[model samples]
Target: MSYQVLARKWRPRKFAELVGQEHVVRALTNALDSGRMHHAYLFTGTRGVGKTTIARIFAKSLNCERGESADPCGECSVCTAVDAGRFVDLLEIDAASNTGVDDVREVIENAQYAPARGRFKVYLVDEVHMLSKPAFNALLKTLEEPPPHVKFLLATTDPQKLPVTVLSRCLRFNLKRLLPDQIAGQMRHILGAEHIEYEDAAIGELARAADGSLRDGLSLLDQAIAYGGGSLKADDVRAMLGSVERGQVFGVLDALAAGDGQALMAESTRIASFSPDFGSVLDDLAAALHRIQLIQLVPGYRPENHDGDDSALISLAERLAPEDVQLYYQIATTGRRDLSFAPDARTGFDMALLRMLAFRPSDGATPAASGGQRSAPSPQRSAPATPSAPAAAPVQQARPAPVPSHATPALATHAPAPAATPRVADAGGMPDWEALIQRADLRGPLGQLAQNSALRGREGNTLVLALQPTHMHLAVEPMVSQIADRLSEVMGEQIRLRFIGDSQGAAHTPAARAASARSAAQSAAEASIEGDPLVQALKREFGARVVPQSIKPFES
Candidate 1:
């Protein structure tokens, strides 16, 4: 009458009941149904991913009282006994504990004999890789040719440790780690069946924390239920797991987006007060940033992370520059790795936040919070982007708007509505490159490519362009074709493009013009900040000196 934990109680008694291991289930089911069972079967995967569970279920399927079938009748004596761990034929071995030649010899000797109470003698060896080299050699021949009545079900989390000789003898089935959605679904089923009140978000937290193990997920769920005093709450689960809510991570990002140093620190303090794992908080931050980046770069991207508030995520995707998100993600992930070397978790976490703030993209386009204490320059004039950066994401600017880079073609053009867009030829005789790009309404990578290119006049029907050496990489066949098609559409003639490396025309490229504009804007912003009465007062009172490199001109 002792209370059984959820993991044990919910342990899959039949193949159909098992979750997130369909491939294994299908093969075993087919084998059982077709009577094509192998003598030695090895199930390998990470812990709690159903390696041992599937082995047991396969054993049950083989020895079921009704018949040898995939669907074991749970009410049958043989099946019930197997489920209860009382089946005489089912010899469960802990290879970790009994990892000697003597133990393996015992197993070998037992294999010669038939099942005591069932059709087949099933030896379920858990953590089979833990067996010593001598033990593996001792049972090697026996494993390859076990008696007709015997079956070997070897399970291991680390299959790599197993001897190739033993591995080759057996039909190896590598089980996969369960996905978050799969684990979450099972948790929901369990909670609903128990009639326990639980938030869906709480289940998600538990599932993610479970880290692709159903048993672990269930164990966490049990603990969460107990901690929440019966009903599972998102706050309680997050508190128990030493993890922050997605909203808290977003709060941190919001503060960064606003350029509010005080708000960022306060958010960090609030998170630390939870006594949460700083590494996990950084993981969450990186994960959010990843999803944000995907949203920014991937057209019509739908997040699969199952966050309830994707609208907010999309808003943030628009709010933060793509490059800023990428930078934050990089810092967060690398910071998480170096957490152990940090003096403490909080300090590491704080330093990571500071790094994000400090390294906030220098392009003058990222957003700064109004009336906020921010030292980082607004990304207005983009930093000199190396051609190596992602095509769509230009690094610089802290404005909430999509800050155009040196290569941002005010006129490159697109697949969007072409009817409303202006024609490039409207500039008359010789096509104005700037007017062509603007009128062509180029956007995305194509726009950037056009922005980085300057029209070196036309060669008959083809427009000759001078492409920056750094940006020549972006001039792929498909992009060229798209630009050609766009130009052909905008100008009432079939236009072809011939790109030449920048020799003299690089100075006249749209990107060059943008760079000049940016330089002037940057100087103006620096002068404005330096000449400000408040900044001058701070300089005199606190001996505060502005870091020149940190200054980026604010772009509207």
Candidate 2:
């Protein structure tokens, strides 16, 4: 006689009707069928995940007039009344409202009596965690050992607040949140049954917006149906949810992969026209990047229709390096975090996109001058500073040639030499391992690996190095190959390298020698400061203490 909301109209009446909680359903089904029922049962989960729904269904199963079974017959008066929320024997209490000890005592007082009409007098308490400590204590005795005709069904979103004493007495069943696919499938089923016209993408948007709550999803569906004039379309749903269109998001990513700043900005302008939530747009970008990474790493993996154009993603994957994708994803997530702190949403998002382009790795080339001379600084290496420049310029200038930031120490050590450069050997003959490593271009992990390694010996073209056990993780295949290549290049001959892990093998590596030198210099500096006559006079006259940390060794 009255209009019913989808949540109410499609409420699950039987255990078989429940979704995404097969584990809990199976346990309850087996227990009920075996007639090995616990007097007290507790169901815990987030809201709209069917905790209260399962409790009501369990109550119906206990009191169904056809029989006390897992599947209750809807035709029976007891099942009908329970479903209608008017069953006298099934007392459904909102513990959120009746949370006092006196209210719990009243329920306890009523539990002493037999069932009014059904086989078992069921007491279903929703949000039971809302009950006070005294009320929970009051529920303990009755909950533990209720009358043979009584059944207690307790539901709560938060079970951590429940006392262990009460929890131990009850059989607890935890309901899990439904996944997006599960929610979407359920919506498709419902829409089909209702004879509603809908786009699958529209359903996907609603499902994602639900954030793992099916009831929330259904409520959103009800709102969507109304908003879309009884028909669901992707654009309408996207607009309603303030979600970015899949095409728009992928377009931004495609532009990013191409390193086209103009195209990316154009796409940003298009995305802005939708008045979409920029944070959500950034989230979509991050998610798409993650999928691209997965696709790249696992070639066998397939993308779904909801993930946007597969061909485009594959193209982007091939165009962009894995490291670049990772960097972009990191920047996007970081920007999303700082979006609120920025002046505006668009500014934050634009900056994040610009950062992605700015940090994109260049191919180590400089645009040639009109006369065909390459005067611009090459992307491969930093230019040497002029002697006339200020003091600060030399610090950056004198640093090692630029290499991929993500390059391992081994890679840094063996960076590619200029094509026109001629092979050079050590001034005299084969230098010692320490001297070779010092001349090696090795940077991060590669440098550390070399500095920690000692050349054991050489056999034919093969070089044997002892690697410390602590740094054995750095002795991977790429690092080993790079070291060998770099060594061969510098020695003006091909060479093979091998590493043996030894705990006490290398204590005199270049890194160790450098550390020893720094320590000696620091000690000398401290002694020099302590012995200074001006320092002694200040300490004696004014009791001015020398700050040990302030002493500098002036390392060469």
Candidate 3:
């Protein structure tokens, strides 16, 4: 005896045997039980999701000899013949092959006659959408007003192609694709009934490969059973499906968390040897990252349900910051779509990895300082040397402790600290207006303006700021309020800021250069602290680290 594949062997003999799609089943069962069947019924869904299969079952139920019911008795001659595809009253037509108007006209002519062997004459049209428009028009009248004994069951994967006129005459039921868990459960039942030995993971792999189609899943299972020679394993299924193992994904993620570029490259090389699809690898990476995000957000996520090595996955998830995991997921998802245009899969994969590394927080290196100079306070002065002639005359000095920036508000009206004193010009006047503006701290769009603008001294209630022709055109029109606020804060006055358009500029003086140098050093030191390797390692390993908002540096 030739063995039937599981798909055909376990095909739903009755509505009870159908795995998913309860809605369609219920509607048909009610129609059959109540004797309220429509003249024409349309079953629509993706291939292998049971559009055709349900049509057959519904046809059988309508003509079953034991009386119409949700659970038709298959032993009756009518049900048995329909199941065997030999019933005279139940005709199954392949609309794709016989779709001309003449074919449909022949069916219309036949519909006027009585049933040959059953209570109802059922015409099951598979892929009904393939019928020509003219064929549909020819069949419309018979479809709308068929004899009481005639039933039309139409099945199509693409119902949109069918004319709306034809659609209005039929009762439509949409069948949905099965979920993975549902498919897996059904496979377990079928395999157990067949006494075939199989691993759960292998079954899961088949379910995922099927992508929500039960028939496709069964077909894959049949192939897997043959490949395994009766017993199936997860590794065998992975190889058969050309799916990347979950462990490799974890390894890549672990390397990323550890910031080990060499380890990442080595893993890529190992994966390349298998000639695995890099696009699939990226997809798996995205899945793994998604799982990690769930773990981070859910508080107690477990990876035990996953079929591959999950220890590394859990470890990496625990180590990497949540934000980094989200970023990696984004990059990998984009890389998957861009893989086809790359020179090769490996190049695409490597470029994606580089992007991830580039955005990753620096381990210890400080980013380069940007923006302009800031004024620094002068050094404290010692009392003038005693005029006394005695050798080793004592020199008195006023040494002031460094005051924190936050402390300045408490003494806003007091004389400035000695170290906070602004630079004085020769012959005892404020520093040159142009030089003063050059020494002010500014950043972002404001910094660009300062580099090209001059200062026209303080007025009674306003500090007049001047810009070069190019700078004025660029900065004078907008951003006036922002410039005013920054200037007022720096000069410690209630002076309003106004920009004057001019082309002249001034170079930084010796004092301004010194101040700028000092400011750059301070910024570099702060950046170094923020990006320290030790701090980054702490963040990765424990999933927590000090951020600017969460912690402040201690004052010495």
Q: How do the predictions measure up, each by TM-score?
A: 0.66, 0.64, 0.65
Model 1, 377-466: lDDT tens per residue?
Answer: 355522322212233432333224455562231211111233444445544566877767877778899899899898887889989899
Q: What value does the lDDT take at residue 300 in candidate 2?
A: 62
Off by over 4 Å in 2: 97-105, 355-556
Number of the top lDDT candidate: 1
Query: Model 1, residue 408: what's the lDDT?
Result: 36
Ranking by lDDT: 1, 2, 3
Q: Which digits, one per residue and each the tens of the lDDT, describe model 2 over residues 33-124?
A: 99998898888888899876787798889889888889999878888888888889888878888866576767766788888898898888
Please give, for residues 1-556, the per-residue lDDT of candidate 3 as tens digits: 8989988888898888899999988888887788788889888888888866786687777777887676778898888888887888877777788877476657655888899988788888888877666666556877767788888888888988888977898999888989988899999999899999888888877887898899999999989988888888888888788876766777677556655566668778887777777887898889889987776566555655766545455445545656567668877987888898889889999878766655532211222223211121112211222212222311122212223332121111221123344453335333354344444555667666665556655566665666655555656545666766765666675546666765443234233444565555444445555544345456756786555443322222
TM-score of 2: 0.64
**Cα TM-score of candidate 1:** 0.66
For all candidates in order, the CA lDDT equals 0.78, 0.75, 0.68
Candidate 3 has its poorest 10 consecutive residues by lDDT at: 372-381
